[model samples]
Target: MRTVARVIAELLVTFGLVLALLVAHLKWGTDDYTRRAQRGLSDELDKVWSAQSVVAVKPGRAHAVTPPAPAPAKGRPFAVLRVPRFGASWHFTAVEGVTDADLAKGPGHYPGTAQPGQVGNAVFSGHRTTYLAPFNRMGELVPGDEILVDTATLTHVYRVTGHRIVLPTDLSVLAPVPGRPGERARRASLTLTTCHPKYSAAYRLVVFAELSASRPRTT
Candidate 1:
């Protein structure tokens, strides 16, 4: 009996140690790696900004003219995203694709979705528990909170409408009019997504916002 108990105890201890290591990697190790990746992406975004121009307009003074931009290459950084509710210093470069390799660097724009400021749903997905956890505090956001998307030509300012927890299989949120598939959209919308409840992909927690106003890129 003593030998059997000792063996079981040893196995349990080993399992616990492995779990701790995995948690540590998910919580801290990945953040360091993502921060370095973000720096590289930011450099690329700077180049895009230098090469592009927008007809400058003061915020809330004139309507923003959102001319379509060419589709960005996969894994390339195309925009800068900021949520003041996350933190004044919080930002992540918005990359072109939502592939694993692309999101490891920053929040990724869903391909085939509307680009920022376009009159359709522009979706972005990011990790909630690993790789900098860019959308970690998404639940704290309420209606009226701002989501800023800065592209080479304009800064789209989105206001939060609401949020929902949906099954991973839910595709309605990807509609041009979110949650209303098959409808034509006439206004720009934003959708941000991440795995729900943290450390699990069983469900998705999505935040919906609308383009309240936009301004020409000044910086």
Candidate 2:
């Protein structure tokens, strides 16, 4: 009886240590790696923008600028996203691909989707409760909130239009017109996607926005 009691106590202690380590990894280790990746991506974007002599427009001013002739290559850092509602310093580098590795770094742009400021849907996906929780507060966004996408040559501003919760297999939410498959795109739009219900991946939470204004980025 004494030996059995000691074994049980040891097992419980082992389990407790394992659980604590898992929580620490999720809380600190993942966030630290993600922050390092985000900082590296931001510096890469700065280098890309610095090579060009772009024009600048005053805030709230809408200007016409041509989108990049060709889309960025897969896994490349193309733009930075800023959500005013998140906070003044809250921003993330948006990479070109939406693969697991790409998203592990930060919010990633969906492949084949329209580029920012283009005449189609620009889709971005991020982790909701892990890897720095880039979109952890995505549900807090409401209509009229501003989302800014800064590229090498221009800054595209979009206003939140609506949001929806859909199944993981619902590809329509990623359509050119969002939720409308087979429809051609007529205007520039932005879509932010993240896992639903905070920590689960059983569903997707999508936030839709449309281009409100765009400005040139001054060199």
Candidate 3:
């Protein structure tokens, strides 16, 4: 009986160690992987923006409405999202899909939604507590906060309208008008979503913003 008890105790310790390692990896190891991925994505954006892939706005078209470009292939990155309120260094490459693999690269654009600067809801989803947690500080955003999205040609600036906490099953937030199904979107809008309360996917925290301006890219 003594030998059996010792074996059981050893097994429990081993399990505990494994669990601790997993927690650490989820919190820190994933962050390391995400940082490396971000660097690569940033480099890709730099190349595209500096290359012939971009369309240069004319001298008199500074405020001209730039139409939305066609969606890129899934998992391919197409833009960069930045929140000034999050800090000067806060930015994430926005990709084409929100699947596990795509989000592992960065914040993802929901397929079938409006693209940046378009007159509809442009939804982006990101991990709240892992993979560098780009939206980790999303809760700190106020109604007047600015969300900037940079494509190869223009920077779309969105002003936060409001935010809400909803259940995981809340599909209304994904509507073309956001929280208003079947309603026509009259203004260009942006919605950001992430797992709520940190480390829990029970609910989603959604932030709503509307496009306030678009600036032609200079550099």
Can you write out model 1's per-residue Cα lDDT over 53-114, one digit (the tens) per residue? Answer: 45558876754454556679898999899998877798889899999988888899999999
Whole-model alpha-carbon lDDT for candidate 3: 0.89
Clashes of 3: 0
Ranking according to TM-score, highest score first: 2, 1, 3
Clashing residue pairs in all predictions, respectively, total 0, 0, 0
Error of 3 at 13 (Å): 1.5
- Candidate lDDT scores, in order, read 0.90, 0.89, 0.89
Q: Indicate the worst ten consecutive residues by lDDT in candidate 3.
A: 62-71
The C-alpha RMSD in Å for every predicted model, in order, reads 4.8, 4.7, 3.5
> Between which residue pairs do clashes occur in model 2?
none
Q: What alpha-carbon RMSD in Å does predicted model 2 have with respect to the real structure? A: 4.7
Question: Residues 110-171, candidate 3, lDDT per residue (tens digit)?
Answer: 99999999999999999999999998999999998999999878899999999999998998
Residue 191 CA displacement from its true place in model 1, Å: 0.7
